[model samples]
Target: MPVGRTRPAAAVFLANLVVASGLAHPAATASPYLLALAVLAYLLGLRADRAGPALVLFGACAALDLALCAVLGVGAVHWFYALSLIPAALLLPWLAGRYRQARLALVHEGWERARSLEERQRSVAEQARLRERTRIASDMHDSLGHELSLIALRAGALELSPTLTGQDRADLAVLRAAVSDAVGHLRDTIGVLREDTEGEEPTAPAVEPVEELVARTRESGVTVHLRREGPARALPPLVDRGAYRVVQESLTNAIKHAPGSTVDVGIVRRADRTEIRVTNSAPPSGSPPAGPPPAAGRAPGHRGLTGLRERVLLIGGTLHAAPREGGFEVLATLPDQVNPERVRSTGEPREESGSPASRRLAVARSGARRRFVAAFAAPVGFGLVALVSCAYLAHQLTGCVLRPADFAAARVGQDRAEVARLLPEQQFRYVPDAVRALPVPAGTVCAYYRSNGNLLDRVDVYRLCYAGSRLAAKDVLPG
Candidate 1:
């Protein structure tokens, strides 16, 4: 399967399982109602609807609490405390999903833009190649064709002259024959150049077996020696191609620049890697002569070497070429397990390595992996943070909601007792004065009786309440 689809499906499944388990055991209620809440929370968390899922989750939690607890309305009242969590659980995931989708869309759009740019570049390259071919054809026609035409015209004029003898006419005929041969050779050279410019046929299948390659080279009037250091096994195609190109280019170089020189080719195969080396001796005179170097950006037009490099690189191999011990040498090594047929079918020679399609596929796979990592990381991180925050808020709500009611009941009982002990005549002045003088800690709300023992107004003097070591709600009057 493509990488993009596999990871997200796994993440959704795992998240559902965790959310369900968390909701089921809220405060030791083992009732099936609570279990049903867990299942509902899992479903809601996984789906796309934000408000609906959150409402359903909240309702399920409240209903389960109501059914199990003996207190009539305590569960329903407590449900209000859970309202704060709805936004975090539902809205956060939806927003994150939207953000992720946007990010993926942006990446795909960028890739498409890049592909368009590459197509433009390829078009420009093809135009440049065509222009170069035209220039070469024009130069060949002007130089070789013009020279042959002039030679033919002068020879014809000489043969027709009145003073010319039979022997002179025969010499002119031989000269014409030589000029014709020159024109034919020039045409053949031009044809080869044209074939190269268009996408011409491949040279030939690479000769296998070092002996066979050496024998083939010998037939073309060049002397070649083949050497092997280890027992030979059938090599991978990439290895074979690299070795063949090294030998072929080395032999061509020898014939062009060091005519009549002997070539030495070596093949060595080890358990881990195979190596090929080709060397040709220096020119006969033993001293390097100076001449104009090959044209700018042209390396003897050796397509074989270029293709060999592509083949090696496709299979994670390496190649090297340089002067070695008074001769030029090319060397290459390839790993053992590479499929030779696949390398040949894919390794086309161009001005660069690999086709555009292969590179695009590689880039796509890399992008998908990055997206997958990001997809899981965001939600898992957010879910953990939400869960921690939810537990903390629930704890705070328990204290905020239940503790105040307990304190109120305690304070009412104490106030009733204080009123019962007060005397009617003395209570008016003394009772109010005593109540006013009583100390209360922070967060204490108190009701005090007047001297006459009737109900007095409530005081939200929580700041006046205190315990000895810890601050807590305190009554202004004793029970």
Candidate 2:
């Protein structure tokens, strides 16, 4: 037997010993031989095949009976009759084993199902977390980056005003320099926010015209030259955005690291693909690069080539950034079919895709809607159904288990005097004491009773208040 079965078998053996001893002392008058038979039967019940052991026990008991009673052939007939118990004992282990196996199977199945459900819930939660992070990062890039860029642009223009006095010029230059630094800091922050650690779908900016994008780069003090060879065709949103960002970042880097260098920005469109190239000479000695100035709030390498490479690859594009003839060069090629509708709908200057802020907002909204729907719908529906089913089952169970007599007694008044008069002999002492112990008012009677039995049995009674021959109130005794 298994270790877990030992305790139950031992308990059954002890209980059977006590029962056999009690039966032997009573009408059975079983002898030592009969006691031996009983012990064998008890042991057999704990093992696999009880029928054989039970038959042996019956034969032993019959022989003892015959030997004591001095009867002829009577013991054999009695033993045959006693053998019927063998089949009943044989069924005990089978029934118990089946029941135990079924219960264990049910428990195992429930545990497996619960584990599966938990895993599914965890997967969904993880997806939701990723979506929320993406949305937040996109929002930060779009809103903050745009505002800082505008500040830097305005400051640059103010410094260029020719009518300013010496002090005014110096102050304007300082302010412009500060603003440029702040813009660089903002770019770094946006770059960090836009990092897609989860490998989520890329949230590229909407496509804009190549010329207009070049104009924006020029405003930021980066010299740009656009060269195109073929009929212009609308590229996919991802392709356009990827191409735009590659050129944008490349020019930004050129301005920041190679001041006074004439950067060549070129866009080539063919029948099936588009290519972009940007190259600028290294900055002049002792002159700060024209890119956004360093600032405390910006991330390191904000305008580095790494962000540009990521943008290019996100849209199925290829990028190459390296030193060429004492200057840096970035080359990229993008496919022509990414997503045309998303590109056209934004309607920003065909060349001037707004800041990353706008692109991030659109992606965040899309992801949030999808995440919210998936998060709550299925589990909440299952829980509501389970709750309703449980309530219905509880109602049915209550109806099935409640006793009709008790229910009726609650609705009707009880007669305490009748209850006391019908009390059984065994219950007479306790029933009267119980009734007298009740703090009932004078002329009112109270008694205790059972819910069901003959009148002699303790039928349920109640505290009865009668006023002028009419029943005033009744309170039934609690079970």
Candidate 3:
């Protein structure tokens, strides 16, 4: 058996030995077999989780033990002691074992719960770090990419100077080439920083006003329109930055995909929310669509929009990009007051329902609750069973007890029917053989009764001898 099983077994054996030492009288030859049998019964009870089987075993053992005691001619004290063994040796040990099982189950469940929480915390932390890193990478790509584009544009303008030397023109060409190479390197670095995420956010500290952004796009040869509504008040940093990004990405997409197409940008700031809408017309009839279509026709699969959506969502906002009419449109709505910290703290996605660890923890917690209930309920069940058993035994013993007055009233040669009126309904079954062996008249059958109703005493017993139907004799045997 496992160690857990073994300890209860040892406890049961020791309890049985304690009971047997006081009650199980050795045979005349001083044999120890009866004590061994009592110990075995106690161990058996400890191993039985159900009360039905354990109670049955205990009842059988008690019957067998009392029978042995009667055959050996032991006293009423031995009978009482043997009966005490039922609760002390068997039920107590069984209850203790059950309690131990519940305690162990609860401890194991506690450990499982702790492990599950730790794993979830680790997952949340890892996801938070990844999000932060991707956002930083996106910021670098936007700010750096814009600066490099301006440098290349300036270098190109310098190359067209009227009085430029060949060496100066060569230097301008080299600077443009270097700027292009740096843009490629920056794209590669941004891809690395995005990890598996489709896109990232922009973080340009220098705020470019909407008018300036429109002028810059016009300089790049893109036809653009800008409109603003509502009060022109200072916006939160997050909202202002997000608004700039929406316009910047929209103009960039228009320049790449709908070159020479008319672009319209609208910004409407209400008391509660800021709305941005960007739309670009179809390209010239012969021009092919520029850049690739978003994967599965989804906005998030578009790299720029994916990062844009992330940034907008972090600021408690929403973004939508899709093809509309003969042009593409991007719409964004941002709340006036951003709570990015709250969003970042709570936005980490989790798979509690689908996670194996979560399921295991749930099961462990359920089992622990059940065990706790069993721990409390098992003892009460045992007490009820014991109480009923004791009540039944008390009833049976009460019926078998013979009062001293009834024994004294009996006379020799009285009719059996007349003597029967003074007798209890049942005989005391554990009357010692030594008493039974006492000399009596020939051809007499004997019936025994406990001398008093007291359950725990070793008082004398009353034995009545009857021949056929007549009371042949009556005697009080020493206990």
Off by over 4 Å in 2: 1-162, 191-196, 200-205, 219-221, 230-232, 269-273, 284-304, 336-479
Relative to the true structure, candidate 2 reaches a TM of 0.42
| Worst 10-residue lDDT window, candidate 2 | 343-352
Worst 10 residues of 3 by lDDT: 195-204
Which digits, one per residue and each the tens of the lDDT, describe model 3 over residues 227-317?
9899988888778888988887777666545655789999998989999999998776854233333336444225666667877876788
lDDT of 1 at 159: 64
All models: lDDT? 0.49, 0.51, 0.68
Error of 1 at 388 (Å): 14
Question: TM-score for every candidate vs. truth?
Answer: 0.36, 0.42, 0.61
RMSD in Å for model 2: 23.8
RMSD of 3: 7.6
Q: Is candidate 1 or candidate 3 better by lDDT?
A: 3
From the highest lDDT down, the ranking of the candidates is: 3, 2, 1
Per-residue accuracy of model 1 over 1-479 as CA lDDT, tens digit each: 13214343333333333333433343322223333333333333433323454445445644443343334322322333233233234334534453454456556756775676677677767755664564355345434443453455356556667898899988987786676556545554654655332321212244456576567557655668888888767765545655665565556555444545678887788887877777788656742221224447756424434444554565657878777667677787777776444443212333332656446545555655654564567567767876896675445333222123333444432444442232122112122233455655445543332211122332222111323323244443432
**Who wins the TM-score comparison?**
3
TM-score, model 1 to reference: 0.36
